[model samples]
Target chain A: MERLKSILLAEDNHMDVELTLEALGRHNLANEVEVVNDGAEALEYLYRRGKFSSRPAGNPAVVLLDIKMPKVNGLEVLKEIKGDPNLKMMPVVVLTSSREESDLIRSYNLGVNAYVVKPLEFEEFVTAVSRLGVFWAIINEPPPGSSRGIA
Target chain B: MRMDSIRSILLAEDNQMDVELTLEALGQHIFANDVVVVGDGAEALDYLRRNGKYADRQEGNPAVVLLDLKMPKVDGLKVLKEIKGDVSLRTIPVVVLTSSREEKDLVKSYQLGVNAYVVKPVDFHDFVEAVSKLDVFWAIVNEPPPARVNAG
Candidate 1:
């Protein structure tokens, strides 16, 4: 079987995670996802610390990050990743419930690759994640982060 | 290579099915667009530079470009390097459209300043939906940055 890249999804909301997983499952994409609950944990996973110490060594093809969270928060995490030369090239798409113009401006200013406003409607959210997978996994290309391209 | 028009999307891919699907997906979207199909990297560059068969084009730069990583005659990475390195065309978004899941494809594309990078879904229905979303986002929702003037 041809390998599919794993997706690292960092979202604090359990329901949101469930729904996202369900939606991806409907389109047969759930098998490729790795879910993390909060910003602090997300960073640990990215940095390979704590429980993530023994986790996969390679970088996720893309990171689906939620904005608000306990501990680090999405913007802070984004800042750290973008600031790290080893991880700066990793494609980050801000998938959050935020609708504020300030968050949008901040995310873009922070050099976020993309910013997606999460929809409250279940169908809309599903469609968003599905398309997000389609574009991030299927269309957009990235310069190999520290992991380093085409097989 | 039609050189007379600068408003053309240079697509690089070896797959006929994906090419057909992309065209079909674009048709469903409301955005009016014109895409120039090239089977490989060499043709993509040729189209960009208005070389050989593309000598008479009028549009100086295409609005956007969609590239596939694995291709004969130069591959996507080399093509991306050339486009980004060229001061004249660096502002234009060169998106990657491929089935590759390797980290290299992702990181390298971003490092090159590619405007967007995406993986084509294997399923047909998913492909249509994905393309439609892209059309909505890049063509409709997301605003392209203003053009850059050459620094003297």
Candidate 2:
């Protein structure tokens, strides 16, 4: 059996994490998610250092990143990932609440794969996350070799 | 009041079955935006630049471009390079919807600044589902770069 690719979620807010996990659960995808609470932890997971040192190798199928978080932050993480060739091909989706034009502009400028604004309403947010989970996790193909890449 | 913001979708595909399937999948959702189909990469460029048969086409860039890798005249990768190279067109999101699963192709597509890459599923049901989700995500969920607003 093929090993299912994991999902790395970098989000600081408890509510958003719960909500996002709930949304993914609705699609029967909650099991594949591996949550990290901050940008620094996100990097650790990606690099297989710190708390993630013993985790199995291979990049996540997709990264659902929140723009605002403690430590490095989403845009910083995006820049780091996109700059490195080994991690450049990894799909990074900016899942955020801010509608600030600058955030959108900078995220795209940093080569973000997709930018999705977190909707305010409960039903809308669920719907948005559901669509994201389905497309990124199930429909969109992760860059080839991600399943074998260590960094 | 909102009509001016409507963004078109440009689909560059040569295969008739794929084209029909994509159209049918999109039709299932009843998307309000126009979908312009081009048979080759050259025509895709022509449409983007508003030249030849597309001379009088609308002024705004597409919300997203669904490009197939293999096509006559120029091909998808070349088209992608051209799009990302041009300052005005660079901001337009390009999603590679191709059948190839080769690692080299995947790496090159991402490197070329293609926004997303999706493999065309062989199963009919899977194909339709993929297209529908992609159409919904790109057209309805994503916020295109401010370039479209400026063009509007």
Clashes of 2: 0
Which runs of model 1 end up more than 4 angstroms from their true locations? A1-5, A140-151, B1-24, B30-94, B97-108, B118-152
Please write out the lDDT profile of model 1 over residues A1-151, one tens digit for every residue: 3233367789999999998888767657677777888889988988889988777576777788899988989999999988887777777888888777667656655667667777789898887777666656654544553221121
Docking class of 2: medium
Using TM-score as the measure, the top candidate is 2
RMSD of each: 7.5, 3.5
Proportion of true contacts reproduced by candidate 2: 0.70
**Every model's DockQ:** 0.18, 0.50
**In candidate 2 chain B, what residue range of length 10 has the lowest lDDT sum?**
B143-152
lDDT of 1 by residue, B6-101 (tens): 244567787899889988887785566677788889988888788878878654666567789999989999999998777665655677888989
TM-score for chain B of all predictions: 0.86, 0.93
Model 1 error, position B30 (Å): 4.3
| Reference-based TM-score of each model | 0.62, 0.91
Best by DockQ: 2
Worst 10 residues of 1 chain A by lDDT: A142-151
- Candidate 1, residue B109: the lDDT equals 77
